[model samples]
Target: MLVNTFLPLPEFITGNILWLAKKGFAITLFLIGTDLSLKVIKTVGIKSVLFGVILWAFISILSFIVITVF
Candidate 1:
């Protein structure tokens, strides 16, 4: 942001930078997916999974309520 303020980029360069940022984001997600281990989840046990599901559901419901009410 500071660099952009000092030396403004042209429209085409800014567009290319956005494209590169998106590609980098996709590559990062793919790398993270490749490193993920399903076996670790299995070892963590069903109770932990159930607790996570409950927490997720609670958060989802709370956010929905907040959005609708606000």
Candidate 2:
């Protein structure tokens, strides 16, 4: 954001570059999912995963309510 303060940047800077950078970022994030393996899932166990999902859902709902109200 700070760098973009220099906006309406010169013609040398184009949307194509930004588009390519965005795609690169998305591809990198997608590749990160490959690190999760079945062994890790088995190690953590389904019960633990269920508990985590429940906790996450609860927190998300609370946050949504709080943010919406205030």
Candidate 3:
């Protein structure tokens, strides 16, 4: 969304923002993934996990379709 909404700007500023955002995303994923355990997964249940994956897949496909069509 931010990428789609950003206005035209100087190349250096845009490059910095893109670099920082990528780093932030990597750190966030690392933090979230580090805490995973069998107990947590079992507590959440297989059904819930599978449902979330399916939902994510559907949204990803939809996004791809819309982006391509437009």
Top-down TM-score ranking = 3, 2, 1
Query: Candidate 2 clashing pairs?
Result: none
Clashing pairs in 3: none
Q: Give the per-residue lDDT of model 2 (tens digit) for 4-30.
A: 577666544656677888998885675
- The prediction achieving the highest TM-score against the true structure is 3
Report lDDT (Cα) of residue 38, candidate 1: 62
Tens-place lDDT digits, model 3, residues 1-70: 3664676677788888889989999867854876745687799898987797799799999999999999
lDDT (Cα, tens digit) per residue for candidate 1, span 1-70? 4566799888788888889999999867954766634676679887886797799799999999999999
Decreasing lDDT order of the candidates: 3, 1, 2
Best by lDDT: 3
Candidate 2 error regions (>4 Å): 1-35
Per-prediction TM-score to the true structure, in the order listed: 0.45, 0.49, 0.50
| Alpha-carbon shift of residue 43 in model 3 (angstroms) | 0.2
* Span of ten consecutive residues with least summed lDDT in model 1: 30-39
